[model samples]
Target: MKINEFIQKYRTVTKLVPGLTSSHTPHVICNDGFEMSVQAGQSLYSEPRDVADSYEEAEVGFPSAEESLLTPYAEDEENLCG
Candidate 1:
């Protein structure tokens, strides 16, 4: 997936080290929920890993880092709501 697509899903892209991030190449999000921009190469290719289980974005809903981080607790969320 492209970086834009990845941003659409995982909104908050937590950088490992902003200072180390480079401008060249494409940036992608890994399955582990981290955005790789620094020293990213063609080998990394272009596939944005989807991290959210059932997380959905509303028409105007802007997902926050905290909200996206809570995706792991999605199962527990259903239990609570159920």
Candidate 2:
């Protein structure tokens, strides 16, 4: 979704929280407990989409726990000998 559209939809519902520094961006906590920062003089987009993209990237880059456990390493023999 476009940044303007996202801001328009949530602007009314979001409340501004105290910023840590002079240039610190304003943050809003959504009804669902999601928090996001709004950049000054710029449109802000949906954070959920960004989070989803990160998860998708992680899923592709990392192996499953079961697969990792099934794999053997040369270090295993070295550790056993010690």
Candidate 3:
């Protein structure tokens, strides 16, 4: 599915889950019963690995150091220099 479509779907499903907080990532139960971690403001566009019986079973993975530093959301050189 497209990223925007995925984001919309995620928002819909998450509303049904209870006790989700905005301060941290939420563990979402997909329609397929596989659980995945969804960052508060981001969407999961791909199938996540490490599915289990519950959302708590889903593991959160972090990007590599290089990826973290170079992400499109990261501050650019111009912003950093200012």
Candidate 4:
């Protein structure tokens, strides 16, 4: 279906990327717990969409599952440390 039509059919759960690419060719999760991306010159979407399985599939990989960032100093990865 067309991107506009898809928007009309489903409520957006969350936008995948916050960067510039998100504005033009957005990859989004819909309220029904499925994922879809803009296609065909930002006009249409492919059919047979799938339920969002993991954040990794969407490139929304988060660092830690912990609720808080306040972790022991030793737990910090060297690359993440100054």
Best by TM-score: 3
Candidate 2 clash figure, as a count: 0
| Residue pair clashes in candidate 2 | none
Model 2 accuracy (lDDT, Cα): 0.31
Per residue, candidate 4 scores C-alpha lDDT tens digits across 1-82 of: 5445544444334345552122233455545554434332211232323222121122121233332332332244543222
Candidates 2 and 4 compared by TM-score, better number: 4
Q: What is the C-alpha lDDT of each candidate?
A: 0.35, 0.31, 0.35, 0.33
Candidate 2 residues lying further than 4 Å off, grouped into runs, are 1-25, 42-82
* 10 residues in a row with least lDDT, candidate 4: 53-62
Candidate 4: pairs in clash: none
Sort the predicted structures by TM-score, highest score first.
3, 4, 2, 1
Kindly report which residue stretches of model 1 are placed more than 4 angstroms away from their true locations once superposed. Answer: 12-82
Full-model lDDT, candidate 4: 0.33
Report the alpha-carbon TM-score of model 4 versus the true structure. Answer: 0.22
What C-alpha lDDT does candidate 3 achieve relative to the native structure? 0.35
Greater TM-score among 3 and 4 belongs to 3
